[model samples]
Structure formats: C-alpha cells, structure tokens
Target: MKILLIGEYSRLHNSLKEGLMALGHEVTIVGCGDKFKQFPVDFSIYARICNDNKIANFLFKSIRKVIGFNLEKIEKAIRFYLLLSKLNHYQHVQLINSDALETYPILSRFLYKKLFQNIQSRSLLVCGDETPIIDYLFKKEFKYSVLTPYFEDNSIEKEFQFPLKYRNKNYRKTFNWLVKNCQNLITSDLDYEIPMQKMGFQTTFIPNPINTDKITFQNIGITDKIVIFLGINRLSYSKKGIIYFEKALEIIREKYADKIEIIVSENLPYSEYISTYNRAHILLDQVFAYDQGYNALEAMAKGKVVFTGAETEFLNQYQLQADDVCINAKPNENEIAKKLSFLIEDPEKINKISKNARKFIEKEHAYKIIAEKYFTSWN
Candidate 1:
C-alpha cells in the first residue's frame, strides 16, 4: 500500500513511516519537522520566508503582535496549499491530529478537503490534545490530567496556547471539518481513546510505534552512583507536570547527593535529546497520562527505567504488574519524590525495571508489528 502521513510529533509519524516501510509499504510524510525537534518528512512543507531565520522570526513576531494574526501560520498554509497538488492520489492518508498543518481554519478546511477527496482511505489519528480531550479534562473526568494545573490556576494561560486554541472558533470549525471528512478516527493511547469513546466516536486504539531496531537496548551499568535524567520542554512545563518532577528532583538531590546523579536537559533537538539520556539509569517522562507517549516508548526501548504513565488501565490492557516496565507517575510532588526515593534506595529494582521496559516495548510497540496493525486498521 502507498500511504501518506501528514504531521509529526515527537517522531510519532517518522517511526510509523519506518514501520510501514519495513512492512513493504510505500509511505510519504509531509510535515513542518514538528518545530525544534526537527523530525524529517519525505516531502517537507516549511515556510521559506518566516521560518528558522532569526530576523524573519523576529519580524513575524512583531507582525503578529500588530496584525492580531500569525504571519508564519499564513506562510505555512500557502506552502501547504502549493504542495497539495503533489500529495494527491494516495492509497491511504492519515493526519497526525486535527491541526495537522497548523494553518488557519478556513484555509486548512479548503486545503484538507482536497487531500481527503484524493485519498482512497482516510484516517485521523488523535495522538495529542484535541477538542474532546481538552473538553474532557475541563470537566474533571479523570483523576488528574495535563490540564490539572490550568484548572487550578488560569494565570499561566500562555503556556497552554496550543491545546487552548482548540477552543477557538476557527480551530473548532477546522477540527469538525477534518473529522467529518476522514473515513476513520484512530486513538494512539488510552489518554485519547477514553475521551473519544465517551464522546461516542468509534475509534481504534493503536499504540505508538517505536523503532526498536534503531534504539538498541543497553543494559544499565550502575555501580556506585545512579544517574537520573529529567527533560523539560518550557512550553509544556506546567501541563506535563514538570514542576512536580523538579520538586522531586530537589528532594533526590539533597538527600542522596552521594548516591544519585541528576541530569537536566531543556528543549534539545530530538537527535541530541535521545542521545543525551544514554547514560542515565532512570528517565523522568510526563506525569499526566494513562499510557506512554513517543518519548517514553523510545526511552523504554533503550532499556531505561522510565517514569511515565503506566496507570491501572495501561497495566490491565497489557496484563502487567506495577513497576513491571515503567513507574506510574501521578500529578503529585511528594508522591513522585517517594517513588524516586524508593528507586534510589533500591538500585536493584532500577536494573530490573530497565530490562522489563525494553521487553515491554519490543512486545507491545515494535515498529514492524505496530505498522501491520495500522495497515490493517487503515484497510
């Protein structure tokens, strides 16, 4: 099958493309490199005038401040429209999310209608926050979600512009249009699947594909000092519950200065970010999720003891025990600290979890196997 994937996020589409290709399917991905992380696409749709260049970025920011509209988004929309002629007539087409192109709603609706008309089988993969997920979070359905901080305090609204934008009239219109056009809706994890199901949308839940072949599992060599790595994305610091992890880190830092080493990286490119965590025995991933995201899966594939979402739903789905693969991190500072201290005191559990993490990824999220599942779903 010849498949066309649109958009990238933490190498989700890139890994899926690799998996599909490995299964003998021709695949083409069109994205704007997911900004900063720079995940590659077969056919890129980046704005030439308002992208990456320091001067252009400054000029565009200034323009947006005055014009009340983003110049960069318009530039990307125009670029995506021009590429539409080349993206047509695919056997299967899947968008990473509702805002796949990150363009203006009216323009995106017009452009995406063309793409949808051309593909034989259409799919919309809800891998991140969207209309329903945000709505669900606002209703306080789950015990704790990414929007927990925002609900408690609305002062840091700037940090939540992306997800909050789904509340925009234009964004909501575009989201509905995309859903209406797509032949199928797919959820990549329990975080999305639960809300989508409650909203009465029949969707398929496929785990995010991880290329285990690329990320070779390395047995952790922990002798005296145990290393822990925490990665922070400034944009999502509050949303992903990074502050709790930071507080936990502080506790770990002061109490176990002799036994534990802490490493913190901020907003590095995907290539450098993955490699930077190589030496760490434990990696701190997101706190407010019911299942692992792309980064957590990659870290697990690399045999690192990852602190990510492995809640009851996730464990029951895979039939695993607590701390079998990765630790389940809820949105609490003291609890997270307790979990870290438990691992710190017992370094032996870290090694066991590291090995289990790799095996879990290989069994549940191997790219080739996941690719086959996606192929079957699309067909």
Candidate 2:
C-alpha cells in the first residue's frame, strides 16, 4: 500500500515512514520539520519569511489586526495547496494531529478537504494537546495534567495560547470536520488514549513508534559522580510541569551537590537537545503525563534513566511497579527531589532501570513492529 503520512512531531511520522518502507510499503511524508527540532520531511513548507523579514512581520500583524488572520499562515496555506496534487491518490493518509498542516482552521479545512478527496483511507493521530484532548483536560478529569497550572491559577494565560486557541469556535468546526470525514482516530500514547476513551470515541490505541535500530542503548556507568540532565523549553515550562523540575533540581543541588553533576540547557534544537543529555545518568523529563513523551522515550531507548510520567495507569498497562522502568515524577517538588536522592545514594538502581528502559522500548515500541500494527489496523 502507498501511505501518505502528514506532519512530523518528535520524528514520530518519520520513524513510521521508515518502518512502513522496510515492510515493503511506499510511504511519503509532508511537513515542516516541527520548528526548531528540524525533523526531516519530503515536502518542506515550514520555512517562514515573517521571522526574517520585518516587512512580512508588519504585514502579518496588520492583516491579523484587521481580518483576524495571520498573513504568514495564508502564505503557508498557499504553499501547501501547491502540493495537494502530489499528496493525493494515496491508499492511506494519516495526519500527525488535527493541525498537521499548521494553518488556521478555515485554511486547514480547505487544504485537508482537497487532499482527502482522492484518498482511500483517512485517519487522524492524537499525539499532543490539541482540541479534543484539551476539551478532556479542561474538565479536571485527571489528578493533574499539563493544564494544572492554569487550573490552579489562571494568571499565566499568555503561555497557553496554542492549546487554548483550539477552543475557539472556528477550530472546533475544523476538528468536527476531521471527525466526520476520517474513518478512524488513532492515539499514539496512553495520555491521549485514556482521555479519548473517556470522550467516548472508539479510537485505536497504538504506542508511539520508536526506531530502536537507530538509537543504540548506552549502559549507565556511574564512576565518581552521577550526571543528571534537565532540558527546558521556555514556552512549555508551566504546561509541561517543567517548573517543578526546576524547583526539584534546586533541592537536589542543595543536598547532594557533592555526589552529582547537574546540567541544564534551555530551548535547544533537536540534535543539540539529544546530545546535551547524552552524558547524564538521570534525565528529568515532564511531570504531567501518564506516559512518556517523545523526548523521554528516546532517552529511555538510549538506556538513560528517565524521570517522566509513569503513573499507575501506565504501570497497570505494562504490569510494572513504580520506578521500575522509569521514575514517575509527580507534581510535587519534594517527591522529585527524593527520587533524585534515592538514585544518587543507590547508583545501582540507575543502571538497573537503564537496562530495563532499553528492553521496554524494544519490546513495546520497535518501529517495525509498530508499523505492522498500523498496517493491520488500517486494513
């Protein structure tokens, strides 16, 4: 079958493309390299003039003020329009998310409608905090989610524009468009799956595909000091519960300053981000997720002990205990600090989880195996 995978996030679709190709299926991907992370794609419409050209930025702002639309997005929609013919006539077409093309709602509906006209099968992947997922998160269904900060204190409205914008009526119409047109809605993680289930959608749950062949496991060797790494994206600090990690790191620094080395980097490009954490024995990942995000999963694949969302829902799904494969970092700063101290005091635990982490990825998320699952589901 010829498959057209739309959009890229943390190289999820890229890895899926590789797996499908290996399984003797032709696959093509069209996306912007997911901004700074710069994941590769076949057709690249992700370039922008507004960022580099003052005139373009001025026009975009002027247009947005008058017409309630970004001029840059209009240009992107045109660029995507030119590629629709090439993207058509596929046996299967899957969007990485609802906003795969990254255009405004109305523009996206026009483009997506054209692309889907000749496609045999249409599907949507719920991989991030988009309209449907945010609708679920808004109800305070989970104990704590990425929106916990806003739920507790609504002062930080500026940081939440991306997720909050999906609540607009126009965005809701586009999402409903996809829901009505697509044959199936698929989830790539437990975070998405649980909420999707609660929303009463019979969506298929497929674990995010990780290319184990490319990511070789590195055994943790704690010689003198345990290196702990924390990466931050300034835009998502509160949403990802990264602020909690920052607070926890302070406690760990104050107490176990002699036994460990802490490295913190912010807003790194994809390649740089991965390299920055390579030397670490422990990685502090997101706090508000029931399952690991792409960065945490990649770290685990490389045999680095990761502190991410491995909640009881995740544990029961995998039949594992707390801190078994990866440490489940809650919203509490003290809890995170205590976990770090335990790892520093007992370095053997790091190595044990590191090995187990690699095994878990290979067993559950291998790209080829996951690709076959996609193929079977699509059939």
Candidate 3:
C-alpha cells in the first residue's frame, strides 16, 4: 500500500510510518515538524521565511491582532495550495487532525475537498488539538477536560481561542465538510474515541504506536535519590493541568528536598526533550487525558513510571490495573502531590511500575503490532 500521512503530532505519524514500512508498505509523511518540537518527516511544509524575518513576523502578527485577519495564515494557504498537486493520488491519506492544512477556513475547505476527491481512501486521525473533538469536548462539558481551565477562568484567551474558532461558522462548516467526506475516522486513544462516538461518528480506536525497538527498556533500580522529570509547553499548560502539577511539585520539593530530584525541560525540541528525561525515574505527563499521549507512551516504553491519565476507561480497555501499570493523575493538587509522594517514598514500587509500564507498551503499543492493526483497518 502507498500511504500518505498528512500531519504529525508528537511524532505519531512518524512512528506509524516506521510501522507501515516495516510491514512492507510504502509510507510518506508530510508535515511541519509540529512547529518547534521538530519531529522528522519525509516532506516538510514548515515555512521559515516570515518566522526567520523577525520584523515581518512581528508586523504580520500585529496586523492579525488589530484587524482580525492573519496574513501568515493566508501565506500558509497559498503554500499549501501550491503543494496540492504533489499531495494527490495516494492509496491512503490520513489527516492528523481537522486542521492539518493549517490555513484559514476558505482555503482549508478548498484543500480538504480537493484532497478528498484526489485520494483513493481518506481517513481522519483524532489526535490532540483537533477542532471537532475540542468543540465536542466543550459541548459535552466533561467534568475535567482540556477546556476546564478556560471555563473556570475566561481570562485564558490563548487557551480559549480553540473553542472560539471551532464554534465559528466558517470553521464549523469546514470541519463538517471533512467529517462527512472522510472514508474512515480513527482515534489513537479513548480521549478522542469517546467524544467522536458521542458525535455519531463511528471511529476505530487504536492504541498509539510506540517504536519499541527504538525505545529499549532499561531495568530501573531502586535508588535513594529518585529523579522526577516534568516537561512543559507553555501553550498547553492550562489544558494539560500543569499548574496543578507545578503546585504539587513545589510541595514535593519542600517536603522531600533531600530525597527527591525534579528535572524540568521547557519546550525543548523533540529529540532533546526525550533524551533530557532518560535518566529520570518518573515522568509527569498530562493530567486531563483518559489515556497516555505519545510522550507518556514513549516514556512508559522506556521503563519509566509515567504519571498520566490511565483512568478506569483506559484500564478496562487494556485489562490492566491502574496503580500497577501507570499512575492515574487527577486535576487536584493535593491528590497529585500525594501520588508523587507515594512513589518518592517507595523505590521498590517505582521499579515494579517501571517494569509493568514497559511490558504494557510492548503488548499494546508496539509499532509493528499497531501498524498491522492499521493495515487491517485500511484494507
């Protein structure tokens, strides 16, 4: 099969490509390296002209803010339009999210319609930051969702922009066009699967693919000074409940300054970010997800106990116990601190969870296994 993956989020498509290739399929990935995180891709649409010229970038941004129209978006739309001829006629094309083209509504609609007509088979990957899923999440009013912080305090303008844009007439129309036109909708985790199903879209839920060969498991030994790593992206701080994690980290540091070591990397490139936390005993990932994202899954594959959203739904889906495989983090500061404290005090428990974490990834999210699933689904 000749497959074309249209976008990327935290190297999800790259991993999937590796899996597909290993299964003897030709796969090509085109993306913008997901902005500064810089995940690799076969074809890159990442534009540096405006961004490299600080003056032009500033002017473009200021103009957008003052006039409610982004010139940069228009430029991206033109670029994508020119790339359309190159993107057509694949056996399969999977958009990473609804906003895969990264353009304004008019251009997005045009590009999506063209791509849908050109491709042999079209599919949608319900990964993070998708407009439809986010809109649905806001509508359902989940008790603790990515939009909770924005709802709790409307002052979060940046975080609130997603819901605002998704609710707009133009964005909604474009989203509906793609949703109706796509042949199959797939979700890598329960976070998206549940909401998509609620919205009356039949979605296939597949566990995220982790390149197990690349992430070799290391047997974590019990050590007196336990290191905990927390990587933060300022843009997603509120949505991922990082404020709560920060509060908990402060408490943990104050209480066990001598026994615990906290390592924090802020917005590092993907390659550097992953390597930065390799020595840590635990990884603090997102708090609002029902299942782990790529980073958490990658960390878990490396035999590190990751504190993420392994809720009851995720546990039952995998038929595994929560505390044993991964730590289910809540939005509450006290509960997060308590969970961190428990692991800090017990080295044996960390080792046990680390082993279970690696095993879980091998069984459920290994790249080959996940790629096979995709092959079957696409066929």
Candidate 4:
C-alpha cells in the first residue's frame, strides 16, 4: 500500500513509517518536525521561511497580536497550495491530527477537504491535541487535565493561546468537518480514545509505536544514589502536571538529598533528550494521563521505570497491576512523592519494574506490531 502520513508528533509518524516499510509497504511522511523537537520526515513542510527569519517571524507575530491578521498564515497558505499536488494520489492518507497542514483554520479545512477527495482512504489520528477533544475536556470537570492550570488561574491565558482558538466556532467546525468525512478515527492513547468515543465516533485504539530495537535496556543495580530524571517543556508544564511533580520532588529532595539525585533536562531536542538522561534510573513523565504518552513510552522502552499514567483503565486494558509495570502518578503531590519514595528505597523492585517496562513495550507497542494494526485498520 502507498501510504502518506501527514504530520509528525513526537516521532510517532516517523516510527510508524519505519514499521510500515519493514512490512514492505510504501510510506511517505510529510511534517514540520514538530517545531523544535525536530522529528524526521520525508517531506519537510515546517514553513522554514517564517521560522528561519527571526526578524520576519517576530514582525509577523507582533502584527498578529496587535491587529487580527497573521502574515505567517498567509505565507503558509501559499506554501501549502504549492505542495498540494505532491500531497495527493495516495492509496491511504492519515493526518496526525485535523490541523496537520501548517495553514489557517479555514485554509487547513479546505486543504483537508481537498486531500480527502484525492485519497482513496482517509483517516485521522486523534493525537494528544485536537479541538473536539479539548473542547470536550473543558466541558467536563476532570480531576486534572491540560486545562486545569488555566481554569485555576486565568492569568495563564497568555500561555495557553491555542485553547482560545480551539474554543472558537471556526476551529470546531473545521475539526467537525474532518471527523465527519474521515473513513476511520485512530487513537494512540486512552486520553484521546475516551473523548472520541464520547463524541460518538467509532475509534480504533492502536498503541503508539516505539522503536524498541533502538533502545537498550539496562538492569539497574544497587547504587548509592537513585538518579531521578525530569524533562520539562515549558509549553506543556501545566498540562503534564509538572508542578505536582516538582512539589513532590522538593519534598523527596529535602528528605533524601543524600540518597537520591534529581536531574532535569529542559526544552532539549528529541535526540539530545534521550541521550542526556540515558543513565538515569527513573524518568518522571506526565501526571494527568490515563495512559503513557510518547515520552513515557519511549522511556519505558529504555528500561527506565517511568512515573506516568497507569490508571485503572490502562491497567485493566493491559491486564496488569499498577506499580508492576509503571508508577501511576496521581494529581496530589504527596501521593506522587510517596510513590517516588517507595521506588527510591527499593532497588530490587526497581530492577523488576524496569524489566517489566521494557517487556510491556515489546509486547504491546513494538513498531511492527503497531504497524500491522495500522495496516489492518486502513484496509
């Protein structure tokens, strides 16, 4: 099958391309490398003209903020229009999300509708970010969500510019059109699955593909200090529950400063990030997800005991017990600190969980296995 994946998020589509190629299918990925993270793709359409020229970028942003027009959007619209011919004529085309093309909402909707007409089968991946899901999440009162901080402190509105756009009628209509036209919806995690199902769309949950072969698993031995690593992205700090993790880490640090070492990597590219904390024993990932995101899953593939979403829903789906595979971080700082403290005090249990974490990735999220699922779903 000739498949075209139309976006890159945390290397999800890149890894999926590898898996599909291993299965002897022709796959081409087109994306912008997801901004600074710099994930690879066959066709790089990240709007380099606007991004490379800092002066122009700043000018355009300033104009957008002052007035209502976005010069960068106009530039992207022209670029996307020129690339439309190259983007067509595929057996299957899957968008990482509704907003795959780097254009304004109206333009993105038009391009998606055009692409849908050109492709034989069109699918949408309900990735971590989508307007419908975000809108739905805001409607309900989640114990903790990406919008928790924003709701608690309205001052953070400046930081969360996307959600404001997401709440707009234009954005909602664009996503709704894509959802209605797509042949099928694919969800990579439970966070997306729950909202998508609630919105009355039948979805196929395919675990995010992790290239396990690239990661080496190491058995953690008893050491003087337990190294806990936290990689922070300011853009998603509130959503990922970094504040809770930080508070928990503060307590743990004060209590066991001599026994544990906390290492933090902030805003590093994907390649540098994995290598930077390769030797760390534990990785503190997000706290508000029902299932692990790509970062957590990749750390698990590396045999790191990741503190992430391993809620009852995730456990029940995988038929495993919590704390056996991954540490389930709660919204409360005390609970998070307690869970971290438990692992810090026990070396043998960490080693056991570390092995289980890798095994879980191999059994469930291996690229080939997940790619086959994609193939079947597209068929």
Candidate 5:
C-alpha cells in the first residue's frame, strides 16, 4: 500500500516508516518540524508535504486567538491547510498530529463538503491526548482514527492532570466526536482498555515503539572509584527537570561530596557531553514521569545504569525492572539522593541492573518488533 504518514512525534514517523518499508509497503512521511537527525529512513520523495516554514507561528497565534470557534481564523487556517493538501494530493495522506485546528469548528464543514470532494483514500488520524476535531466532522463522514496515550489504566490520572481551564466548548465537542468516530483507540497497557471503553472509545493494547537497533546497548566500561550520575536534557532547566536534578545533586554532594559526580547532558556542543556520558555510571533521563525519553533510551543502550521511573514494558522486555532502571522518585531531591546512595553503596546490584538493561532492550524494543507493531496497526 502507498501510505502518507503525517507529523513527527518523537521520531515515531521514522520508526514507523522503516517498519512499513520492511513489510513491503510504500511509505512517505511529512514531518511538521525538524526531522529527527538520527533517523535511518530515506523520505526525500514525500518530504515536501511538511510545512516547516514560518507560517506555523502565524497559524499558532491565530488559532490561539480563536478561543471559541472563531470563524475568521478557522477559514484562514483551512485555506492554508487545503492549499497544502491540494498541492500534495497525488499521495494518500493520513494526518497524525494535535487536533486543535480552527478548521474543525468553521472550516471542516467546507472540507467535507467541497475541499476533499475530489480526494479519496485520504483522512486524518488523531492522537487522543488532547481535544480531537472529530465532533465537527462526524456527520460529514471524514475517514479518521484515534490513538490514545494511556498513562495508566485504573487511575484515569491523565484526565485529572489537566485543569478545567484548558477545557473549551470547541475542545469538548471535538473530543465527543473522537469517542464516536475513532476506528480504534490504543493504550500501551492492557489495563487501560477498560477505562477507554467506559469513556466510549474503542480501545486496543499496544506498547510504545522503541528503535532498539539504532540504540544498540554497548558496554562503556565505567568501573572506577568515582561514581557518576547523569541528567540528560537540552541544557534547559525547566522542561527537562534540570532544576530538580541540580537540587538533588546538591544534597548528595553535601554528603558524598567528592565521592560522586553529577553530569548533565543537554543540546550542547557534542564535544561537551560525549565524555560526560563516558565517565558516568548512571544517567538520569527525566523526572516528569516514570518513562524514559530518547535520552534515557540512548543511556541504557550505552549499558549505563539509568536511574528512572520509565514504564515497564520496554524495560521488562530486556529483563530489567523499575528498581533497576530508575530510582522512581518524584522531583524531590531528598528522594533522589536516597536512591543514589543505595546504588553507590551497592555496586553488585547496580551492575546486575545495568547488565539487565542492555539485554532487555536488545531482545524486546528492537526495530524488528517495533516495525511489526506499526504494520499491525495499519492493517
């Protein structure tokens, strides 16, 4: 099948495209922003669909101004998207991105009525984390699918995490449409299926895709007197939880002092961080959640003992446990310090977990398995 995958979500398109290729499907990707530099796929043929220009800023501001279905901005954005869509109509496209478009409120009626009147085998695929635009297009019969990032199954914690202020009538209407038109909604954990069903969205179980082959776990061999703790983010203190890591390091430095070193890796000069990871025994990925981002995955691939609360599926596939992967602490410095002490004092346990980390990812999160998952989803 000839497929057009739209939007780039944490290198998801690159991985999925590779999988699709292996399955003998023709795949092209249209990334929204910067393409993942490390992706191993060749998408030059279909890369033109990406709207990487300065217009994104204008669209964002205009959409923000449309608090309650502001029709003027909606028409403007629709004209923009439609022009892009018309330009790329040769390919069967599937738009996968955030669904807060002004087009849904004012322009979707037009999209369903006339814009796509000539187009077939093209539709939008919405991720179910935020407000979906399905509600407005339901009666219009737009081909669509919904995928949810179920953080947990039992708690329904994700919903509560967002406050009521973020809610808008437009958003609610779109979400209601998603619950009705979504071909399927996927959760990483099987436990989430029930909650999704309760919410009136069809649910399926699918783990997060990991490109294990590219992240090959190698033994960096850090057997020395100085223990290292790593924090990986783009040097920014706010988004990557750098402040929390710094506070925790301060507490540990007061006690351990010169015994341990804390190194932070951000989007800095490559020369600066290359050695930092090499010297460290443990890399701290993120404090926002138990799951590891690309940074954590890269650290684990290097065979370093990663202290994180990253989800279990990816780690468990390698026979690694939560205790082994991360310290599983909130952004509390004291809590992080306590976990650090345990790892420093007990080298044997650390070594065991580090060993498990490499093996688990290789066996389970490899590209071969990930590619298959993508194929299953499309089929």
Candidate 6:
C-alpha cells in the first residue's frame, strides 16, 4: 500500500511510517524541514511559513514558553495559518493529518473546496486527529480514516486536554461536511470515541505509536551522583507541569540537600541531552498526566527510571506497576518527595526500576509492534 501522512509532528509519523514500512507498506510523510534532521522519513514536504506571521510565531511561541494564551479563537487561528502554509507547500500524495483542522474553517473557501475536490479524487485521506475539518471532508465517495491519541481507562488529563468551547462562525458548515462525507474516526483514547460516535461517525481505536529504535536504551550504572531530569518543550509551563515539577525539586533539594543530584535539561544541544541523561538516574517526564510524553519515553529507552504522574495506554500496555517502570508522583512536594525518598534511600530500587523500565519498553512498546499497528491502519 502507498500511504501518505501529513502532519508537522515528526515523532508521530516517524513511528507510524516505520511501522507501516515494516509491514511491507510504502509510506511517505509530509512535514516541516526540522523533522528531517532528527528523523528520516521516505518523503519530505516542507511547510514554508510560520503562523501569526514569522514575528508573531516567534513572539507567541516565546511567550507561550513561559505562559500559554487563554484565547481559543486566536490559538485556533494561529494553528490554521501554520497548517495552511503546510498545505500550500504540500506537493505529494493525498492523505491528510488533521493537524490543520482547527484552521481549515477559516481557510480560503475557494482554495479549500478545490483542494478538497482534488484530494477526494486523488487519495484516501486519513484524519489523524479529531477536528471539525475531518467531518466536513468526509463523504461516501471519498476514502478516509482517522487515528488519534488514546489515554488509559481512568484519565484525569483528559479533563485538561479536550477543549469544550464550541462557538465558531464556520462550525456548523464543518459539522455538516463531516456528517455528509467522513467514513471513519479513530482515536488513541477510546474515551474520545463516544463524542464522534454520537455524531454517527464510524470509530476505531489506535494507540499512539512510538518509534522505539530511535531511543537508545542503555544500562550505564550510577556514577557519583543521581540525576533527575526535568525537560519540557519551550512551550507553556502550566500544561507541561514545569512549575509543579520545579516546586517538587525545591522540596527534594531541601530534604536531600547535597545528598542527591537534580539535573534540568533545558534547550540544550543534542549531545548534551544524551550525556545529561547518562549522568542521571531519573528523568521527570511530566506532572499533570500519565502517558509519558516523548521526553520520558526517550529516557526510559535509555534505561533511566523516569518520574511521571501519568499512566496512559502506553504504561498499561507494558503491564508495569506505578513504581516498577517509573516513579509516579503527584505534582505536590510531599508526594514527589515521598516517591523520590524511596528511590534515593534504596539504590537497589533505582537499579531494579531502571532495568525493568528498559526491559518493559523492549517487550511491550518496541517499534516493531508499533510499526505493525501503523501498517494495519494504513493498509
């Protein structure tokens, strides 16, 4: 099968493409140029411009790093422009990732309608995320599929992740498009399926695929000090739980004070990221949720016991208990301290969890398995 995946998130397609290729399917991904350096995909489609203007992109992204915006429409508009530039530069096969859905409504209707018609005839469009655009373009005549992120059974993070506001000038139009055109909706979290299903859209469940091979999991024992990694994108601190993690660090240092080491991986060079983890024992994944973000997953692959409060599908897939694979702790100081104290007090537990963490990933979350799922979905 010849598959085309459109999205800016490199990790998303990197794993999916690897999985699809392993299953003997040919895959091509269209995304930003930056993705090419870290991940090599079959084909590359570069989105030339930044949204909100290049200056706005820089300022907004920079400001968003410290604090995110509360304006929904503005946020959605920015995303739309980013994606429009993506489509404008897109020159390849037709399947679309819903990364641009929020912005599609406001897009030049004439161009969108033309593109929709072109895609309808040229390729089987797959919606990777849930957005109104997916619904609008879904038609009986057009072949399409949706695959999304999935959370665990009991997810507190979902409350924060899903947007609730529904006022939009073009929403009804998009909704009507979806009802009339889409064939299926797939979700990483099955919980999201209900809403789509209620809309009478076909639904399926596919967990987020991680490219395990990229993560070099190693077992280099403790050096003189232990490292606790705190890495979040240059995005907002609230959603990523940086503030909570930082506070937890304050408590940890006071309690241990020169006893344990705390290393924060900021916007460092790639070489530094690898070496930093090698020097540390635990990498703090995230605060507000479970499903270790890419940072934690990468750390886990490197044989480090990651500290994350999330327990999403990926965690459950490994059959790992809270303490076995990672040090699951709340954002609160006391809770983080308790979890930290246990690992610090017992060197053996760190070694055990570290070892198990690597083994669990190999057994359950290997790229081989992940690729299979991607292939199955695409083919």
lDDT, model 4: 0.85
Cα lDDT of model 2 by residue, 1-379, tens digit: 9999989978899889989999999998898887777888898777478545788778778888998877667667888999987876689999988888888889999988888878959888999977878999998979999989988889899898888988899888988899999988989899999988998888999998889999999978888999999998888889889888989989989898899899999988888999989999899989999999989999999999999999999999999988889999999999989988888999998999999999999999999999999998888
Instruction: Report the C-alpha lDDT of model 4 over 179-240, residue by residue, as the tens digit.
Output: 77888889999888888777777899999999877766777775678999999998888878
Candidate 2 backbone clash number: 0
Q: Give the Cα error of residue 166 in candidate 4, in Å.
A: 2.4
Go through the candidates in order and give the clash count of each. 0, 0, 0, 0, 9, 20
Model 5 per-residue lDDT tens digits across residues 150-247? 12232443333332212457546544544444344545322233234444555454544556655555654546654565544442233345556678
How does candidate 5 fare on TM-score? 0.64
lDDT scores in order: 0.88, 0.89, 0.84, 0.85, 0.50, 0.53
Q: State which candidate, 4 or 5, has the greater TM-score.
A: 4
Local distance difference test, candidate 1: 0.88
* Candidate 1: Cα lDDT at 137: 80
Q: Give the alpha carbon lDDT tens digit for every residue of 1-379 in model 6.
A: 6555544342556666777677777666654423223444343333223343687667666765678642333544444344444343233233333333324454423334544543432322332234442333233221211111112223443433322112244544544454344343444432233335555656565555656676776764775666777765543344455666788788879878766877776755444556666777887766654445455666777788887644444346556566777776455667876788777777778888878877766775677686665445433
Candidate order, lDDT descending: 2, 1, 4, 3, 6, 5
Clashing pairs for model 2 are none
**Deviation of model 3 at 4, angstroms:** 0.8
| lDDT (Cα) of model 6 | 0.53
84 Cα displacement, candidate 4 (Å) = 2.0
Which regions of candidate 1 deviate over 4 angstroms?
A: none
Q: Candidate 5, which segments miss by more than 4 Å at Cα?
A: 34-96, 100-128, 131-166, 188-200, 225-243, 265-280, 288-295, 310-322
On TM-score, who's better, 2 or 3?
A: 2
Top candidate by lDDT: 2
